[model samples]
Target: MFFVDTVEVPGLGNRSYLAGGRTAAVVIDPPRDIDRVIAAAAQRGVRISHVVETHVHNDYVSGGHELARITGAAYVVPAAAPVSYERLAVTDGDVLPVDAGIALRAVATPGHTPHHTAYVLEEGGEAVAVFTGGSLLIGTVGRPDLVEPRLTAALARAQHASAHRLAAELPDRTAVLPTHGFGSLCAAGAVPTDASGEPTTIGEQAAVNEALVKDVDTFVADLLAGLDDIPAYYAHMGPLNSGGATPVDLTPPAVADADEIAARLAAGEWVVDLRSRVAFAAGHVAGSYNIEAGEGPGGQLALLLAWLIPWGKPVTLLAESPEQLAKAQRELVRVGIDRPAAAATGTPEEWVRDGERPATLARAVFADLVELPASAILLDVRRATERASAGYVEGSRHIPLHELRSRIREIPLGVPVWVHCAGGLRASLAASLLASAGHEVVAIDDSFDNAPFVNTPAADRC
Candidate 1:
């Protein structure tokens, strides 16, 4: 009588679920955009009877409060979670009746947060699925360092215990549906999967999840060691989620013209180009940063822009068309980049100021940089882990993209910079930033695999 439907917010790499029997359903870990959850409930032919949260989210705002209000569903939150709203406070072993022979049983599973809970969906007293929100994930566990630095170590230990506890108590076949695993920053490390590469289970986790397979000490050490930079925007998500984040305002911002666009840039506000990296690299308005807009495997606009730009910086968007602008706006709001201050949609030529030419940037593959020039600076902008995982060239300067804005001055004014990331996406971002800063840049529009090719003379594998 019950079914589970995943509502994936691919941009942020999180999932909300709408699952229940024939006539009623419950939503877990919904995104800031509640309409998708509402639509899922309607499509399931069930009314939302309960809206549940496993924890106060740190990645995106929760739609649970508003969804419950809209549907008159019972709002369920973990007991003692620091939420400002009223909710059905459920603790370990608490059961919420769903339908005939169907129910959700809450199990206290901290580590992701002090009050994090995982819900076990049961049919006829048998575990059907476990919604492991930011806890035990596919091949890893929720990162424990999102909380205060002082609590990270303790939380890492607790994360290990929580995974073991879930594995020990639940039936091995119980489906493990985690909110953070499919590219979510909340996940600590890479996710390993079987040939199928699908959602995991308790049985599968025991072999692949470090938290379940390794001893607590080893898992904690490895997890802590693998921790990377957290998204800067996460600082606001927890407070907004707990304090009842309002519905996202994705209504299009007032459009801007070339004059306004130039003025915003001159005033030190961000005017991001939401075009393809190649399109951006070919030509764009002077000082406008390039964060290409798309939501596939290569789409890094939302994450990269929110990470690089100073929080609450006034933003103006430049896109090739209205459709591209709309999509980019939605992506921004998913990460709490609510309303853009102003926006413009047109070709790069349309955005150029009077007496100014559309600026052009150069792009090259790794092979093009074989013989280092005395006049050029080689910059590597990928995270430390990526550089470590994939080895670096001999003389490349290392400054990760996230830290590049504040550290821009370290690179001299007149020298030309040749920048590259693991792939071309981040290098394009770095290239644009360097251009805006008055330094000539060439984006290494090739994969890092080709870097080793340039070791001796020229031309290696891409």
Candidate 2:
């Protein structure tokens, strides 16, 4: 008998798999935190015999090396990948037997990267599931533009061919498990989710996935045109994965006093407050950025930091408790934002002991925007696709959160700016950025769904 379990790294928007026979199992595309995988295997009473990498991921750090080392598993990787580490390099058509009735067959499926492979798990001589990684996603293939600009067009074409190949070779009933399409930026476009918001199968996707139905040239053009700004941290992930990255250190960061934190902030280092948005808006250290450790939609620390913060900048973390600081550190390390320069945990009262007043921002809801004075500015910081699908408040200035830094000067100074995104997370971050730039800002820390003008015009009046 064979069984498979999916271990979701919700913060990173990727899923790793543990599949095995009764006695042994294989782990695929694990995140940097390996403890979860180990625990999952322990529960199943199976020794992990192999660890597989579908590709050298560009979005998050890989835990394959560390997982394999700890479990005494064969670290399996693509034969074409350039790495100095010891691993069992696999090629297309290579098959590894996991146990008496189960085996994983390698299928070369390159597109998201120059060297990518998908593993088909067969039980009792029948195909059961294919771990498609970034190649063949739930509703769309992985974006081909993460590599060099010159290779994007060619890789997109390759992506289309690879998708067709998988569809042709695999039976319709084969379960399609992918790593990139579930709210990750690695995909070319947004994929629809099931009731549980998890990805569906190859059979279901073939009927609905637009990429599968479009011509190769059209698909390639559309994929490239739809690409958004790559996160600055992505450039660091590829190299780190190719060479092995050290196992993440989840130890609590050393506590720093207010004086040290102030000095660091004065030095232009990021002093992030990982508290609730409500707590942050009420009071926080002057010059601190509010990311809110485990709040908002999924509250992915790595994704938000990578997308917003400039690369290689030193970061200091401030949280409400030692546990909060430790949790934030674990999430940040998965995306290679390891080892914050300093950390401190305390209430705003404790932090403001030096006769310094903590900064606060005005919080508002969508209803307040209706009676806004003409002098006040309403800035929508959601992505273009979000604005298009769910209409924005009319007359609001549109600038995505990722582009806010470069375009901050466009908003006039001395104006009260009200900032909002699909949810309150980006809005809080944007409000902090705007405030740092000397604008009077109000962050709308509420769900956009509750906003009356999402799908209708404003004149209709909630």
Candidate 3:
């Protein structure tokens, strides 16, 4: 019997899979944190025999090398990736036996990247599943623009062809599992889900995937038009993955005293407070920035911080406990934000014991908008597509969170800014950014669904 297990990286909105027969298992597109994959294999009483990558990932660091090293498995990658490390380079029509009655066949499926590949899992000579990676996602295909701006149009067209090829070549019931499209930035937009809320099969996708049904030209245009701002850290991910990123070191960082943290803050280093937005809003180091530690809709701490923080800037983490600091460190290292400059764990009161007062930001709910002064401005920090579909508050100045740092100057200096996003998580991060920039800001830390919007010209709402 053959079985498959999904390991979800919710912070980046991606999934890695472990599949195998009776004696051995193979890991597909494992995350930088390989411990989970190892644990899954151990639980199933199987040894991981192969670690496979679909492409050079652009979103998070890959753990293929580490997993292969630990398990004595063959590290398999597409022949086209310009990788510096040694591994088994595969191409189209390559088949490798993984275990008794189980084998993986490589299928050339470019579009998400120039050299993307998909792996078909065959059991007893029958195709049972295809790990489509970023090529053929749940209800959509991976965005082709992550590699280069010049290749986007051509690759978008290729994406259409790739999806059709998969549908025609594979059995209709072949299970289609993708590494992206579950809120990952790699997707063009939200992929529609089935009524059961599970990933649909190739046959279901052929009937409903928008990119597969449309002409190549139409699909390319739509895909390109729907793309949003690529995360800043994405530019650095490919190189790290290709060159073999160093193994993540999860050793707890050296704890710093309040004075040391203060000195670092004075030196213009980022002092990130990893507590709840509510706890942060109540009291925090005057110059600290609050980006909550654990899971949230906005994104994971590692990916979110990697995208938001300017590259190469020294960061110091502040959490409420040693465990929180350790958790944040593990996530941060996965995205190449390895080894924070320093770390400290304590509450605002403990850090401010030197007679210094902690900083605070005013929080507002959706209903509080009515009480704001007329001179205050509303700022919508959601993606362009989200604002367009949901109809944002009329007359609100739009600046997606990813683009907020560069476009901060566009916001008026003297006026109070009321900021919001799809949920309160993004708004909290934005509010802290605005506060750090010396602006009077109130975070609408409430669901946008509950917020009121003026019924005005559709153009203004969008």
Candidate 4:
């Protein structure tokens, strides 16, 4: 048997496979790009017989249905799935025959999603590996709140029972292969730790991982607290992954020239600039979102959307170069923003002037805060998702940077506004948006220290 793990860091997800003697293979949690899965199977002279989904994911689009459509492999899921799809569904105690001596057993593990399941691969009745999707991670368990609250509670309970079942029923030697690992928000807390920093043993996880089989009450409490606010786009992306709809072509559409990109931008299209923050800081088109893809993954897309465009607006692409725009489009799809407006065909300098917000805005806001009235609102326009994960300055009204345009009426124009994001990137963007709308705004640099905002000392009065 041969096993391969494909990590799609671009999509912030993972997929794995089990190849038996180069003739047949079973893929688990295939990424949105199914070509790679096919390519891997072909390399080993194997054909994919089954495409397995441990659970319906909410983070990125799933390729299971598409893979099955292309390869004619059976799309397998838990029998209890409420959603409809063209495939075979199995439940606990059910075993899928892969070969004369090899089989995959479906074990219902419903914490992340109600119908979530895991596969225990057995060879000659010996358990070799168990594919735990969101149910179990290296250092954590799936967050129960990914679904309805009532269902989440039930799944949490089911997760506790299912984890114990795996710990007791499977052999200690069974290799634990999960769909996600460190750095994924799907998990609960710190990643699983081993001496070598590689995947750890189930035995090690059971002993140290708090979510493995702890008491139900403690398990539920810990799971809920760490549940960070999901990105605004997830509401639109999850259903599309359940095979409900097709994603629009994200490839930058062919345009006549820079005017076309500008026309799209003028029509309120999302323009994502995938330049370095330093480059963007030096100059970028007005109203264009700066992802600074140069910044490492994880929060690249989130930072781009939360800061550049307000929530609930369509997306368009604007990058430093054509290659950068193409790269940014793929990242956008992962977060559910498809068919980004036609990208700027020419250089960044061709579309707009490179001037930045007057340094006076920051200097003015800081000076005003020292003697500002209590009624002067110090608004932190960062997304709720960003603010919760990394604590925010106390008492700041969080009208996400993107929503500032729509909700500007909510704020009294006379009150001073100071906005910010994780770093100063989005804050600067937010400041620009507020300023254009005739609001007195300043962008503050993120300071994670647990201190009150420098000027508004009384604002901290809870």
Clashing pairs in model 4, backbone N/Cα/C closer than 3 A: 139-192, 270-316, 310-402, 316-341
Q: What is the Å distance of residue 72 in model 3 from its true position?
A: 1.4
**Over the stretch 2-49, how does candidate 1's per-residue lDDT look in tens digits?**
899988777677788998998888899988788888888787789888
lDDT of 2 by residue, 28-112 (tens): 9998989989999999999999999999999999999999998899999999987879999999999999988999999999899
Q: Number of clashes in model 4?
A: 4
Q: TM-score, each model?
A: 0.95, 0.93, 0.95, 0.80
Against the true structure, candidate 1 has what lDDT? Answer: 0.87
Q: Candidate 1 at 163: error in angstroms?
A: 0.5
For model 3, the stretches where C-alpha displacement exceeds 4 angstroms are 192-198, 296-299, 454-462
Residue 343's lDDT in candidate 2? 90
Question: Which pairs of residues have clashing backbones in candidate 2?
Answer: none
* Better structure of 1 and 2 per lDDT: 1
Ranking by lDDT: 3, 1, 2, 4
Per-model CA lDDT versus the true structure:
0.87, 0.86, 0.87, 0.65
lDDT, model 2:
0.86
Flag regions of model 4 displaced more than 4 Å: 10-21, 99-101, 189-197, 244-251, 294-296, 302-314, 353-419, 424-462
lDDT of 3: 0.87
TM-score of 1: 0.95
Residues 429-462 of candidate 3: C-alpha lDDT, one tens digit per residue: 8888889888999998888878786444366654
RMSD of each: 3.1, 2.8, 2.2, 5.1
